[model samples]
Target: MRARALVPGVPALLPSYASLDDPVAPLRAACLSAVGELGPRVRVVASGPSGRRVGAALAEAVGAVVVDADETGTLVVGNGSATRTEKAPGHLDERAAGFDAALRASFDHIDLALADELWADVTCLVGLPPLADGDVRYDDAPYGVQYWVAVWG
Candidate 1:
């Protein structure tokens, strides 16, 4: 691939979900910058419809077109863990930290069952290279959701 990017599939990143204060400003900026680096034609890899929509939105915002073939870039949408805190969507799974840490190490071997329990969106990450192989722009569990904005070439 000429260019590749990884971003969380958070609905907050969408323009339609914009709030007055913008809770995800930094993440949005990072996503936009990574997406902007992608060429005009991008192929989006996402686990579900929401994730797909988020990828499409980011690509569109950067003036990139979502394509099925002849892609100049690839946008992969997924995240680590969602049960990082008590208020997390998955409600504080004690195993979240370890699971996310292992995931950060490599995406080559993921336990789908455990991932599901922790609310991790990693299905689209199956064939992609490790995140450590790229430039990680953001890595945090803001609002209890583990998010990473990374890029590869």
Candidate 2:
């Protein structure tokens, strides 16, 4: 399964996405112009601890789906290694587990740094999804563990 998220730093956003299967690339590329940024890569918690990595950790983990990344925005997740699970601006009670692979952040072991310039306004993404049962994804059937890391615009 594949998920795509849109942390659109702009108003007229397009289809932002995070995917697991190979079919997600085209959909992601198609919305680049409209969204102004590309998606970053994260990992699935269910995939394992070592695989749960990502870029733009600060923004990816907390920022809203449509918040501005400029001015009051925080680029703490900037192209750095220590920011694998950086928290966003308004996060007050984030836990170690919550920041690393919580939600859908852990999916594909992300290495996409901000400097990579995959896209313009987009941030990070992963191939994992958090199960509704409050557990990490373990199945590789596309919908299992890759749900949290990816979402759609």
Candidate 3:
């Protein structure tokens, strides 16, 4: 139960979305490094099926098995606002930056309604300890989607 990690459930991280040039190379490396630290058993918490798939792939990539209970580590998949820019998946939302800023400060209080409007998958993000208690390996909005790769050990 010591290991904990959070990675955005971006399709770009999945093999199915892999490109010959590898658009998300740095993100993949950060995810692998973080997921590698989780022991042999990992409990994955994701907002939806797609996120679950991403978590499963990451855990398997590191030789870890996804377990339902009694896991040695936990992988929570989620992300902040996706409407950060004009090219964002959900398109630009004027409230996105402020929303993401609040999230960065604390996951303690989240505007679920606004999150949905901004296309943020934060259902699994609630109740986590805090990013301040861990190391944030990656935090950027590449492709206009806010993604974070963090681990707590």
The TM-scores of all predictions, comma-separated, are 0.97, 0.17, 0.97
Please count the clashing residue pairs in each candidate, in the order shown: 0, 36, 0
For candidate 1, the 10 contiguous residues with the lowest summed lDDT are: 124-133
Q: Tens-digit lDDT track for model 3 on 102-138?
A: 8887888899999999999999889877788889999
Q: Please list the residue runs of candidate 1 whose C-alpha ends up more than 4 Å from where it truly belongs after superposition.
A: none
Clashes of 2: 36
lDDT tens digits, residue span 50-78, model 1: 99999999999999999998999999999
Residue 48 of model 2: what lDDT?
Answer: 23
Better of 1 and 3 by lDDT: 1
- What's the lDDT of the predicted structure labeled candidate 1? 0.92
Top candidate on lDDT is: 1
Clashing pairs in 3: none
By TM-score rank, best first, the candidates go 1, 3, 2
Residue 34 CA displacement from its true place in model 1, Å? 0.9
CA error at residue 15 for candidate 3, angstroms = 1.4
Location of the lowest summed lDDT over 10 successive residues in candidate 2:
73-82
